[model samples]
Target: MSHHAKDLLTLAKAVIDTEIAALAALPSRLDDDFLHACETILACQGRVIVTGMGKSGHIGNKIAATLASTGTPAFFLHPGEASHGDLGMIVNGDVIIALSNSGTSEEILAILPVIRRLNVRIIAMTGNPQSSLAQAADFHINTGVDKEACPLGLAPTSSTTATLVMGDALAVALLEARGFTANDFARSHPGGRLGKRLLVHVRDIMHTGTEIPQVPPDASLQQAILEMTRKKLGMTAITTPNGTLLGIFTDGDLRRSFEKGQSLHEQPISALMTVSFRSINAHNLAVEALNLMQEYAITVLPVIQDGSVIGIIHMHDLLRAGIA
Candidate 1:
């Protein structure tokens, strides 16, 4: 390789190595102080206000987002903006998380007096535990690493990565403690794929009403095949005299019957159908339907309610909706 290429590879490797080492060194830092920070945030009735400067600000913004999404109500405030008049956003019941690798971000420190006056408890994340911000904090978290990924050792790299991970750790710990469910996560992420996975129900995607592929149990095999073909669900439900689902017959069963020399026109679907096939509830989650299909080694499941066939769901439907 040319010298330029080799130099680029070396720099990339150095950056990754610095970050990996910094993360590996974080386990020992999870001490009583981390628990104290979580406890403080949990006790706060208002939102979490995170602020920092430069790259720390960027990491703090992401941290705030993660916290908000995982069940904690949080928002990011620029320290400079707070000093300029945005400090009104912070409430007395709120908790403040301030990030400064050196523990002396001028912008963040400038607003400390005002935040203290508001009486919002502050948690400091810094490299220097003895710095002014750290000393003044209600609880201090050490996000310090031995060095930066920058070759000149001046840019924020490993320190930022460590801070972000620590923030996630805190958010996830609080998430578990609060019994935050997937439904709660979906409410916060209604526009994202995660929301779709959690919010969309089986009835939302299942073929209902006339779209349901169903036939009476005593119906001829030919009639069941016609229902399957019309619905395009690759399967037809066998219903009892009272409209309760008795069994289901799919293309696989049709093929097996043909191989057994059973005449399609004369055979009864109830005799040919899989009598003990798995069924799903229309009110269940779409994700649950996906799991049922996978576990039974089948591509289709009949959705039933009160023993009556209400709809049918196929693996293709789940995939097309991005659930699988």
Candidate 2:
């Protein structure tokens, strides 16, 4: 390789090594102050206001989003904007988490007195424990790193990563402390895939009424085949006159019957149907349906309600709805 290429590779490895070493040192820094910071946020009745400037501000935005989605209510505020009018967003019961690698950001320090006057709790995430911002806060979490990943040592590299990880640690600590569950996380993220998996029920996407492919138990196997073919669901439900489900006949059963040389046109569907089958409730989650399908190696399920066949759900339905 050329000298230029070798030099670039060397610099890249050095940067990666520096950042990895910084992360490796972080576990030892998690002390009583970290626990106290978590408790302060948990006890907070109002929102968490995360403020920073420049690169710190960008990381602060993501940290705020993570906290909000994980059950700790939070939003990012620009320290420069807070000095003008955004300070109104801070209230008595709220908690302020300020990010500054140097622990002496001028904009952040400018607003510290105003935050104190509002009687809100302050948690400072900084690289320097003795800096003005850390000394002024109610609690401080030191995110000090041994060195920057930047070759020039001027850019914010390892420091920003450490700050982001510290923010995640705080958010998750509070999440566990508050007993946050997947259901709660889904509620806050209703538009995402996890939300769909947790929130969408079998009834929400099941085919019901005229759309369900079903036949009476005494119907001919040919008639059950016709029903399944017409509905294009690959399976048919056998029910009584009162809409009570009895059994199910699937394409797999047809292949098995043909293997036995059974006459499809003359045999009763009741004789061909599989009485021992798995079914799901209408109220169960769509993910549960997917799980049931995977466990039994089946593609479709009859949705039951109060001992009656209410609807049918196909694997394709869950796939189309983005649940599978």
lDDT of 1 at 9: 99
Candidate 1 per-residue lDDT, tens place, 1-324, comes to 999999999999989999999999888989898999999988989999999999999999999999999999999999988877799898789999999999988898889988899889999999889999999899999999999999999999999999999999999999999999999999898777888789888998998889888888778887888888999989998887687988889999889988999776766888898988888888888989999989978999988889888888999999888888
Candidate 1 Cα misplacement greater than 4 A, ranges = none
Give each model a TM-score: 0.90, 0.94
The per-prediction CA RMSD against the true structure, in angstroms, equals 2.2, 1.7
Which segments of model 2 are wrong by more than 4 Å?
Answer: 1-6
Candidate 2 per-residue lDDT over residues 1-324, each given as its tens digit: 999999999999999999999989899889898888998998899999999999999999999999999999999999999988999999999999999999989999999989899999999999999999999998989999989999788899999999999899888888899999999999998988999999999989999999999899899987898999999999999999999999999999999999999777777899889999999999999999999999999999999888788999999999998898
| Candidate 1, run of 10 with poorest lDDT | 262-271
- Which one wins on lDDT? 2
Once model 2 is optimally superposed onto the true structure by TM-score, how far is the C-alpha of residue 312 displaced, in angstroms? Answer: 0.7
lDDT of 2 at 249: 92
Whole-model lDDT per candidate: 0.91, 0.93
How far residue 41's Cα lies from its native spot in candidate 2, in Å, is 1.0
